[model samples]
Target: MLYKFFVKYLKPYKKIVFIAPIFMLTEVIVDLFQPFLIQQIIDKGLGAGNINYVIRIGFFMCILSLIGILAGLSTIYLSSKISQNFGGYLREDTFKKIMSLSFKNLDHQSPSNLIIRLTNDVTQVQNLILMSFRILVRAPLLLVGSFFMAFFTAKSLSPIIVILVIVITVVLYIIVHKSTPFFTNSQKALDRLNTVLNENFTGIRAVKAFVREDYEINKFDKKNENLYSSSTKASLATALIMPFLMLCVNFGIVASLYFGGQFVIGGTLAVGQIVAFINYLLQILVSLLISGMLLMNVSRAIVSVKRIIEIHDMQPDITYKTETVDNIKGDVTFDHVYFKYSDNDEYILKDINFDAKAGETVGIIGLTGSGKSTLADLIPRLYDTTKGKVLIDNKDVKEYSEKSLRSQISIVLQKAILFAGKLNTNIRYGNQSASDIEVEEAAETAQAKEFIDKFPEKYEKFISQKGSNLSGGQRQRVSIARGLVGEPKILILDDSTSALDAKSEALVKEALANEHKDTTTFIIAQKISSIKTADKILVIDAGKLISIGTHEELLKSSELYKEIYESQLGKEA
Candidate 1:
């Protein structure tokens, strides 16, 4: 999976990945020459009692050191370039993919996990690229080069080299296999920790209101402990690699000295030969240790690659067309609509049929979880109906392009979400090209201008994250203003006035009726007063639309409607 992902994403930087290794090989070659040069200095210069020869060879070694330094620097530069570009491109693609996914697809994916993949996971892959250009490329080259050079130079020492290599190889394979699964578990632990944090911050207000600080702390500590344990276990598993390899390296050193000393005493090897043999042995063992570290990194990188692959393979559930429908007038119709979250789930909306003409106020009133919001959601195609059609402008909603359909319909969701920006910027979000006058008009229409004008900065006042700086009603009004700024043909207010006082709600309703008379509207509300004056009111019970008529007519005909009215209006009805 890592190989495939790298090939697909790093195609642009493959040349750099390839070239960096060439420089690494150059460094390795230069390193391999060092032991031989030392051997030459000891045998020819020192043994012959020639100071000039010592000076000449020592200077030549310095020149080789310079070349090696240059090669190492070049490899570092190229590696950094490849890794950063590779990571940058992958992050960009992941963000774009997240944006393109349908709401249904997003429901299954955790935001915390997605964030980890974009940041920590991609960073791990970037590290793999860096290691590839550095130790990954150089280690094997130095290991092989030193071993063969030692073999050809001292055939008698071959058994020592072969045995040490075999022992280290077996040890590395076992350690890496044991540690690979731990890396995957640790990544999951990180996701869980981030999830706890996200929930805490987003609902910090609720936590404070209920005084559940200790409960939240306990939750965080539990997740944090799991993350700690998982990370420590992974670290322990890989930590074994370094010591085991070092022990094997020491064993090789002992074998080299014992065997080579005997050979020198027997006159079969010179002192320089034994010394050079030891040098080569050290190089081989050191390279093996570096190779072990690289394998540990590969294990972690493989886990991240698998995670990223999961996201890359996801296809959006709702497909949209690029072809726009002409004159989208927002004439919405639900024709025998049936909807369920999935095939196995019960229908949230069942056998529903209704129509709202191009310029009328349609009110949907129901109890909690009675499908008022879900039914309203169909008008903008947030979720497609499972067994029927939702039509816009008399055309199936799916027939219009996403931009053409959604851009014409504005929905201020039940939550009244506001972003961290100036008031003007928030309002202009619906239509970026809306002029200052248009923005002010929209705010006035939503009754948001009253409070906004009180801010010292007025429209330029900086709103905090999620509008935490504002009151609930203020946030709701800001959201309504944002929706109205685009002058959408269809506007759906899903319990948007629930936060406002009765007077404030009345003012907003009066402004909407006067300013947006030609806009088709849907009001999904729990309070009867909110929708009492709507042109047509639809009464819903369970998942079915039970009655549809004017307010006075429904009070007379529907027991359910009359029950709701009597319960709320309290005999004043």
Candidate 2:
């Protein structure tokens, strides 16, 4: 199975692989010729006292050595080229599969697990392919070739060679079988450590604010200790292979010398033939030892390959429908939609219905865990609704191509993620074709221009990873600007203004009113003031739409709205 996988990827670089074996063949022939030459130097040159003949053979040996060196260099160069292209192709394929995954599929996988599959796991498979070309092919060919040469040259000593090969193969099988589980577990333990460290680094501010640094450190220490222990065990197991193989090799040599010496004394074998027979025995044992090492690597590679393949084979739950939508308007309606996370038994969003026409603004307000975000995610098909239809411009979202439907809507999530890039690059992420002037205009509208202009590089200033250098409000404003850059027909701002102060929030609101008058916007927020001026407010409670109307209408009729308003505004009435 592993060999077939390499052949498939390497098929494209067939010319390289084709050239590689010819090099190996030359190297092997040179290797085989060396032992015979040693016998010739002993029997014909040194024993007979012929200087010119010895000189000629010695010169030919030099030529053979040069040929071997050139062949080895060419083999390594070609193998490296194949390995690099093969590794790149596999990593690219895995990444594309990850990009195609839906939120449902992503939720089921850990970030650390995914990272391992991408980096460590892919590297393991890559190393195997590279080594297979350099060492795997060479070792097996050398072993079999040496065994056949040993028998052809001297049949009497062949039984000893066969016995030693059998013993070494059996010993290697036992060691690898016992060590396989340790190698597999080591990969899992490393993933655990990665997960803990990733979470800690991401939440360092929270940990420090809560004065839980020691606690977090201890938690990390525990995970680190587990990784350390697993690695020690795996290393110890792998360490056993070399020493055991070396011992077996020594025993094979002693056995060959003891038995072959008798043939020499009886005149049944020439002194040179006995030496040649001993050299063959050593060659056979060396090949077996090399085969053992390759098997160990192949075992680990199998586990790593399976890890990578797991992600490759995953079928996304929310794949694109075959149908396509050429034109999609701003009309959106949720009809009796119900949803729950795959791991959860209870629905996060129960049966719900609502609509927002073109050029209308809808405000969703509720207490925490009211399923507000889940409701908003339905329109974009981020997660499939369990029980109902979410329509876009009167057609079910599933009926349209996912790309076409998503392209028309822009969502500024509550988290407000930003990548490491220039300020303009981040803003223009929603539409890469957006000009610098367009990006600056969106930034001004989001109330981000004043702060952005203070930077020395202005629009070209680098935003650190996830915008860590920027304040929370600044990050939120930049995220809002990105969404606005798309000029989306439908925009969903999920508490996007929560990080800004009241004054900046008002300025952003005014900008939205002036710039996006024709667009349908859904504003989700906790502060009553944020949605007080909205055209329609939907009061949601536990995944259900409790009431929908203007702000004043809801304040008069909805008790939930009244409670939320009084809590935030501190007004009893």
TM-score of each: 0.97, 0.96
> Which candidate wins on TM-score?
1
Cα error, candidate 1, residue 261 (Å): 0.8
lDDT of 2 at 59: 92
Per-candidate Cα RMSD to the true structure, in Å, reads 1.6, 1.9
Residue-wise C-alpha lDDT for candidate 2, range 1-573, written one tens digit per residue: 556666778889998888898898888778777777777777788779988878988999999999998988888888888888888999998999999999989988889889888888888888887887788878877788878877876677888888878888888898889888878988898899999988988998899999999998899899888888887887787788788878877887787678778877877766666667678777777777777777778778889998887887789888677756556668888888888886456888888888889878899999899988888888788989999899888888888787687778899998989999898999999898998889999999999999999999999999999999999999999999999998888999999999999899999999999998988899999888888888899898988899999989998999999888888776322
Task: Show where candidate 2 strays beyond 4 Å.
Answer: 1-7, 322-325, 571-573
Q: How accurate is candidate 1 locally (lDDT)?
A: 0.89
Name the weakest run of 10 consecutive residues (lDDT summed) in model 1: 322-331
Off by over 4 Å in 1: 323-325, 570-573
Candidate 1 clash pair list: none
